[model samples]
Target: MNGTICQSINQSINQSINQSINQSINQSINQSINQSINQSLSLLQVMEQV
Candidate 1:
């Protein structure tokens, strides 16, 4: 009984940690992608004007 309880507690902790990590990773990835896309778009516009 004690072992099962400990296992469940560990599982919950691991799940929460994984969730937070994934969220942060996804957020940063999205931000970088947006930045790169915006930069490229601006560059294209400048090229067109030139």
Candidate 2:
């Protein structure tokens, strides 16, 4: 019984770690997308000036 409890606790910790990693990855992706959008907008503004 104690072993089962330990196993469950370990699984929970692993899941939490995985979730944190996934969240960081998503955040990085979102940041890159925003950066790309900003770059595109800047290019459009420059083209309009010409």
Candidate 2 per-residue lDDT, tens place, 1-50, comes to 99999999999999999999999999999999999999999999999999
User: What does candidate 2 score on TM?
Assistant: 0.85
lDDT per residue (tens digit) for residues 1-39 in model 1 = 999999999999999999999999999999999999999
Scored against the true structure, residue 5 in model 2 reaches a CA lDDT of 100
True-vs-predicted CA distance for residue 49, candidate 2, Å = 2.0
On a 0 to 100 scale, what is the lDDT of residue 50 in model 2? 100
Off by over 4 Å in 1: none
- Reference-based TM-score of each model: 0.86, 0.85
lDDT of model 1, residue 36: 100
